[model samples]
Target: MAEPTISVIIPAYNAAAFIAEALLSVLNQTSPADEVIVVNDGSTDNTRQVAASFEPHFGGRLIIIDQANAGVAAARNAAYRRASGELVAMLDADDYYLPAFLATARRAFTLMPDIVLFFGDTEIVDANGPTGRLNSEGKPVRTLPAIEIDGLFKVRGSTFTTLLEGSYIPVCAAAVRRATALAVGLFDLSVRTSEDRDFFCRLALRGPMAFSREVMAHERIHGGNISISTHRVDLARNVLTVMRKLRRPEHACLMSDQERSALEAVYKDEFFNYVYNLSSAGWRAYVKGVAMLPADERLAALHPKHLARALAAAVGMSSND
Candidate 1:
């Protein structure tokens, strides 16, 4: 069996300052990418110039797809359409991969014929340096790696089940087979945010996924990070919406009854979290979220106290009352 060819697809938007580092990481990969595609989604900065500059260095291995101010999902879709490799390595403009990332993923695909996707842990950083490594719980800590192994990748337990619990798989740390990507239809553009979550959820339904313990990629955390800049309320709301759609009968049918029950439990957990986050914002968001809740699930999912708090927040009264 031959190792799969990999394409590193980066979607950049006003990422001039960081694009070079990302490109360099790809260039320095132990098992270098077979193709490098960067889609400049209408960046006003030098992102286009900086990314396009790599074409010559790649010696025609680089592809620059310039498009209007489309979102990251669309930009990735464009790059994927142009990618010819058997595996697509999803890299973010603000993040860079460890030298072993592609080599590790390719080796996994070559070894495990059933695995279609895999993600590794990410090292969280800031302007200073490394802060901590992201854990399975979507948190950061300066702890040791999740697992110690001489090998590049580790085939894990139920990827789908773990993913159903939370959205911990960072975009920068994952790679998927090109065929599997097409089968599920890459990214969902309708979502304003959490498109990565949507895409990953769909992929989880497809088949098995692997995990890399230590740090496989770098995730930069700054004030200007997308999760910070984007509207949190809207993003959180869309997250629930997307999750509901993803867990519908068509997709949820693949899961056993226990899995489906677990899926519903998480959905409710997310719903309450969403409402709690909006409690301070006032009634409009609360009303919207409640309205979005289905009639069947409302009585069980939405507590009276939650509604009372929303009403209380709308008025001058304290929420405790």
Candidate 2:
């Protein structure tokens, strides 16, 4: 069999309700993926069965690998090892891609062969309504200009700083060259969350990344999502782990005073937010972060916007009481 131009890897765990839609979205792509590998990470539900249903439709083009219960990072790494394509794309089992995702990615890669990674805007949908927007903070939400290598460094720090502060790019909306991903050593399985952020930061250090204006991915926000249900303590711990990793020698030269300050502020906010979410010992973590901040900048983290949100949350809690 010939190698495919693009390999889509979907890591699924107990995603029976949405895995079928996710697979269909890929199969319906105008420029269908040459290979689609779905990694079943010891799902307790019918995730494997749902993935198997697509094999008859996609035939040899679809591949399924069952593994012990591992985190998404480990699952993704396992899938990447098995993929044989120039371009590697990721689609979470619960997220569906737009029909134009692969076609747009192919065109973008062809136009800018030097780009190591490419990502598009994403739409957020929930049971209540559609957010109808991409994160406005990182990599401007409007139409992206054709950027070159020189342009990358000019905005890399600011863009990455914003993304690290909060997850701006949906995991399902990203695609990277296989070689670049391998060169970067794939995702880190040590951290439970923020693995994608760490992976992108490492990749950004290697080569230029292109952005597409169109929202080629749909992110479903549901009660079951880790982002929504996971305890803030766990989230904060993983975020801190990611931050500590960034301070290593490989990324040391890239860190500027402003970038470091931004990172510190983000940690402070996370600590406070964890407290607001009622996580145990969050206050202690917040105090520790505050103590670490430079005296002059400690107050900067208590910006009016954050203060207001914290106050609002307090009021809501009081009302519930």
Which model scores highest in TM-score? Answer: 1
N/CA/C clash count, model 1: 0
TM-score of each: 0.86, 0.74
Q: 73, model 1: CA deviation in Å?
A: 1.5
Q: Write the per-residue lDDT of candidate 2 for residues 1-321, one digit (tens) a residue.
A: 332399999999999999999999999999989899999999999999989999988978999999999988999999999999899999999999999889877776776677777777788878765677564434443423344442221223235565566555667987889998998789988877778888887776666677766688888887764554235656766776677677667675666677677776776666465444432233344455445655654676455544454455445432221
Which residue runs does candidate 1 get wrong by more than 4 Å? Answer: 132-157, 224-232, 278-280, 288-303
Candidate 2: give the clashing pairs: none
How much does candidate 1 score in TM-score? Answer: 0.86
TM-score of 2: 0.74
Q: List residue ranges in candidate 2 displaced over 4 A.
A: 1-4, 128-158, 224-230, 254-321
How accurate locally is residue 55 in candidate 2, as Cα lDDT from 0 to 100? 94
Over the stretch 113-139, how does candidate 1's per-residue lDDT look in tens digits? 677787788888889877874644433
Pick the lDDT winner. 1
